[model samples]
Target: MQQWQRQKKASPKSQLKVTFLGEAGVDTGALRKEFLTEMLSEIERKLFVCNGDGKGKNPVYCLNSLDQKYFRIAGEIMSVSLAHGGPPPSFLREWCFQYLCSGDADHLQVCTSDVLDMEMSLLIAKVNDATEDSITDLTDEIINCGYTGVVSLEKKDRIVRAIVLHYTMRVLPMLDQLRKGLQLYDLLVLMEKYPDICLPLFVPVHSDDRVNSTFIMENCKTLFSEKGSVRRRQECG
Candidate 1:
């Protein structure tokens, strides 16, 4: 992905040509589309973590990935992919997509389900499911997560909201970098103006329909063994 950044000097208006390092192929247009599709698919799986029901995704907060500016790379890749007839991210959470479009979290309707971190989500769940007997034990967990407010059955709602807020707010810096990368080709502008039209580009209605072995089987050509050979018999079996 770092290699793609070298394209900063290249003209965005010109046609993009894609080529593999070792593989040889002429990219009239199909190869470019294939490259963009594969790139976006991999980024969706690797650079982010699944949220509720494992459908929506939130960016993984890694100090190393942040220092390396992976979020920026991801943004730029998505923009290029979209501009060059490639797929959109289509895996981001609704709140995340909203933040990208508006450049702020002020209007985002976030909830405990929005939190992606397993440990944090589990802790928040415990707080929500806490009873009169469990409130004291859950108090320490909440406080350890940086909540200063008093914890009780009555304050569980407030405590949960604070934790979720802090969790979501922590990703703002990373989102800022992603926004920077998305500045390419006025992608962010279109998103801001036509949020409804561009919604599917970031968040899909049927996110569960992901790429799988079926895609490979359908797209890839099957090679047959020579007729009457042992390999052919084995293949038939």
Candidate 2:
């Protein structure tokens, strides 16, 4: 890790500049497609690990402590974005929200209900099958190994969601801010040092004739519209 950090520090810096386009020049169709593609890819990657057959090592487990922190931060950012009327990232909607909550219910109620019971039961079965142990024994071992406690499934879901929400909220805005021309190397350094902003520090933002500053900014504004006090109170509380 130290060696990698030193190498990163010595790396050359790059910058990503984002600009907005005027209405006359904007192609809403192309922009929408690009946005959907990026979001879908991100969601699919996250869910693949959770739903994959027990075979090769899980990338989620392979992450170092710092990387894990960043991952959770990213999750939290997505959660807050959803709460503020931003579109819920596909992964959060499918994996965390769907399993943890029911339609029109609070997160707490969702966690405590039977929403995830079937999924958890299947997951437990898979674990026991792989480990050659009884379900109860494997569950106990899982708790003892410090992954999570033997609490009710809902409680466990609530805890996981809390961690996810925290990280996601912090990471997304930071990524958005990077469009203001932060050096790629500096961004990498920040992520490395903080270990809580899960974005890749070197994402390239290309601007062609078709996609300009107005388009980018307008899309962002539309997606992340400011929610006033009433919405904030309802969502946050």
- Using TM-score, give the best candidate's number: 1
Question: How many clashing pairs in candidate 2?
Answer: 18
Indicate the worst ten consecutive residues by lDDT in candidate 2.
Answer: 196-205
What are the RMSDs of all candidates, in order? 15.1, 14.8
Give residue 59's error in model 1 in angstroms: 0.6
Taking the tens digit of each residue's C-alpha lDDT, what string does model 2 give over 1-237?
Answer: 132234344322312111235534454444534443444356336522333322211113223433434343343333323222233233322222321222212332222122222334354444534532344444553453344544444344433444333333333332332222232323222333332222211111122324222333344322222577676666655
Candidate 2 lDDT score at position 131 = 31
Model 2, runs deviating above 4 Å: 1-29, 32-36, 47-62, 65-88, 93-95, 98-123, 126-237
